[model samples]
Target: MVDTRIPHLPNEILYEIAGYVDDEDILNLRLSAKVFEYITNDRFATTFFGDRAYELSPEGLEALVKITEHSVFAPHIRTVVIGHGGKHSSAKYHDLLDQAFRNLAAHGNAISIGL
Candidate 1:
């Protein structure tokens, strides 16, 4: 249910509250109500690929690509951190990273990759 009280608050207050939480929480809050969605837009969200970036399963990589290409979330994503855990072959990680980079680039994101 949408909290009517939040939407009534000043936008400054709402954004101040949002700044106290992590990006994941902000994303969830944005989904909770229209008011939150508007407030969250000020800071956008960070999409962290977590610690297993190099160990992602095929399905995980597909999901990552999907999110990166999503029109709604794509614009809000301010950061994407894909790290290597050294458990996978270099070629596999490279392929995954390359695909992700392409998806992001196609969506107008500029990224720098370092080996």
Candidate 2:
């Protein structure tokens, strides 16, 4: 009897199977199994973190900080898009923006910023 369970497959075969799927499908595969997630970690980091857009809100900036600090995801970031909905007049917003930029500078992986 052929054991055809997904986890029974070798990493190379799983990787090849993952290569044929779209981004959304890949995400689903990752969620479906730990082995899939482990094999696709590099691809996931590159595909998702290669370019990201965030609103210029406290939460968005905080998320950006978290990503920059991530050892695995940081190196994959190539571009960051900052969406300023409108002019932010609050000092707190400015402070957050400043801090976020500082973190990005330290990360030094994101080479492009789209405003």
Candidate 3:
């Protein structure tokens, strides 16, 4: 069973813990509680985008853009990953990414293309 009477964590330590997790984990942890959310939302609001740029199609692009454009994640993103897989023969994916980057850039974060 989960313990309900856990000791309170020190402020400095809790903020430090938020620095080590990947972006996805941050997203998960943010939803766990308001305290965790405030700490993480302040320290790790940005994400690298990683290779996740290749994982979307046109419709997916729209969805992805919409998700990131939300209030909680928009300003938190400081960096992004925008590289496409070489195995793709068609330029369609690249075009999709280009447009996505345009959308992502409009929000005022640093964009790392050719990632």
Candidate 4:
């Protein structure tokens, strides 16, 4: 039988490494283990959303709003980068953007929205 255990890593080390990983990889890491779940969370908002501001979509915006719904995860988001330029500017996209901002505003954390 093959050993499938992951090496133990400090949270600080994991967080540092996370900065270089893309959103998909970071989200995947969050689901790998309890420790990684903790590690990925420390920078979830910034790493996942901030790094992919240009590629934001309605689905992505919805996901971001869902995370900010949590009190623990909400404060990690200090800056929100919203890209208004999209090839398809549909009503659905606008609705998602509005909802995302409203959700963030409800947190009352004074987040700065970047373009």
Best prediction by TM-score = 2
In candidate 4, stretches whose alpha carbon ends up further than 4 angstroms from where it belongs are: 1-56, 84-86, 90-92
- State the number of backbone clashes in model 4: 0
Model 4 agreement with the true structure over 1-115: per-residue lDDT tens digits: 7544544666566667666778768777777677777766656765544333433666667776676677666655677676657555546577677766677678776777676
Query: How would you encode candidate 3's per-residue C-alpha lDDT over 26-110 as one tens digit per residue?
Result: 8777776667777876445445332234344456556556645666665555444443355444366666556555666776756
Q: How many backbone clashes does every candidate have?
A: 0, 0, 3, 0
Against the hidden reference, what TM-scores do the models get? Answer: 0.51, 0.77, 0.46, 0.48
Clashing pairs in 1: none
Residue-level lDDT tens digits of model 1 in 41-110: 6455344431113235566566667777666555444455544455545566557657776777776765
101: Cα error in model 2, Å? 4.5
CA shift of 60, model 3, Å: 3.6
Off by over 4 Å in 1: 1-4, 20-34, 41-44, 47-56, 75-99
lDDT of 1 at 85: 57
Ranking by TM-score: 2, 1, 4, 3
The true-structure Cα RMSD of candidate 1 reads 5.3
List, residue by residue over 11-111, the lDDT tens digit for candidate 2: 88999998987986778989998898888888999888899888877788788888877777787888888887786544657766676667667767546
Residue 100 of candidate 2: its Cα lDDT?
61
Give stretches of model 3 more than 4 Å off.
1-31, 47-52, 76-99
Candidate 3 lDDT at 27 equals 77
* Cα displacement (Å) at residue 59, model 2: 0.9
Stronger candidate by lDDT (1 vs 3)? 1
As for lDDT, the candidate ahead, 2 or 4, is: 2
